[model samples]
Target: MISLTSPVETRAHHWRAGIKLGALCASTLILFFIQNWLFQSAFLALVIVLYLLPGWRFFTHGLKPIKMLWPFIVLVGAWHWWSNELQQGAIIILRLLSMVALANLVTMTTRLSDMIEVVRFLTRPFAKMGFNTRALEIAMALVIRMTPVLIGKGQKLTWAWKARSHRRSGWRILLPFTVLALDDADHVAEALRARGGLTNND
Candidate 1:
């Protein structure tokens, strides 16, 4: 497995990868706006081509996360199907799938350090608006670090519930995860403050 902890070199590499991913996303959205069947077909075909080509890295993660998100995906698909005309529904679903694939590509290829730098630079221009770039950076870092842990915790909670054959719904799974997430976030915030990660004075 490639080490996700290691950093990538240069801002330009980040920009290039981001641009490629963004362009694909933008084009798909544009196609959806036109709401034409031909454009949807073409975009879907291109997505298939992109998936088959090596080094795309998005599909390389290999469907597990997509599988995990299937329930939400189906719910959204149903909403689109019922709320729109047939042509519009098809376009909406295709656009959504394309955007999702591109997002996965961005996360798979982009390094954590580069992502942080991009966030820092992107937020620096907003300093004049009284925004604290340091806080934002720390927040992003915490999110990146804690997201996987949170997901793992949720998965464990689900498994435990299933093992007990409980038919509980909604907050039965959510309340504990929310409490655990909050406690974890509080600990992270304390650790960062101890390290002076939130200092305003440079």
Candidate 2:
């Protein structure tokens, strides 16, 4: 099993792995947006192949966690069945699934530090544009890192509420989530200030 002694180290590892995967995903997404055909097919094929990676069984790993949303998917499928040709609908659905799976893989394998460096380097050329690369990098890193934490918190909160037989009330749960999330945001802002993140004026 993969083991890490600290959250920072874990996040750093994730950042690196994520940047590599995210690069591909981001590039493909852009090409799709721009209708670029040069490598779109290749990227789509890569998306399919990535599903065959270790621990990526669609029915087991992908579907199981989000099984609660199966009804929604079925409803979408039915709607597609009615409103459009099945062939076109199939392509859209498959593309959506591929994008989601690729994103999951990137986030799962990447660390926040890796994301920070990627953003920093990407923004380096913008120093002349008055963009604070450090601040942007830190913000992006924190946002990426918080996603998993927020999900984990939501799950734990749901479980605790269920154990106490609470009705999954929104206000009570949202209170803690909002508070903790704000605290994390504040911490990130302080860290940025300490590091002189806004160095664009210099």
Which candidate has the highest lDDT of all?
1
TM-score between candidate 2 and the true structure: 0.59
TM, every model: 0.72, 0.59
CA lDDT of every candidate: 0.62, 0.57
Count of clashing pairs, candidate 1: 0
Q: What is the per-residue lDDT of model 2 for residues 37-152, given as tens digits with 9 covering 90 to 100?
A: 33445665776565444434432443333334456567777888998766555555555554555555454445556555666667778966766666676556555566657767
Best by TM-score: 1
Question: Clash number for model 2?
Answer: 6
Tell me the spans in candidate 2 whose CA falls farther than 4 Å from its real position: 1-27, 30-51, 55-92, 109-111, 166-172, 194-197, 200-202
Give me the displacement of residue 137 in model 1, in angstroms. Answer: 2.6
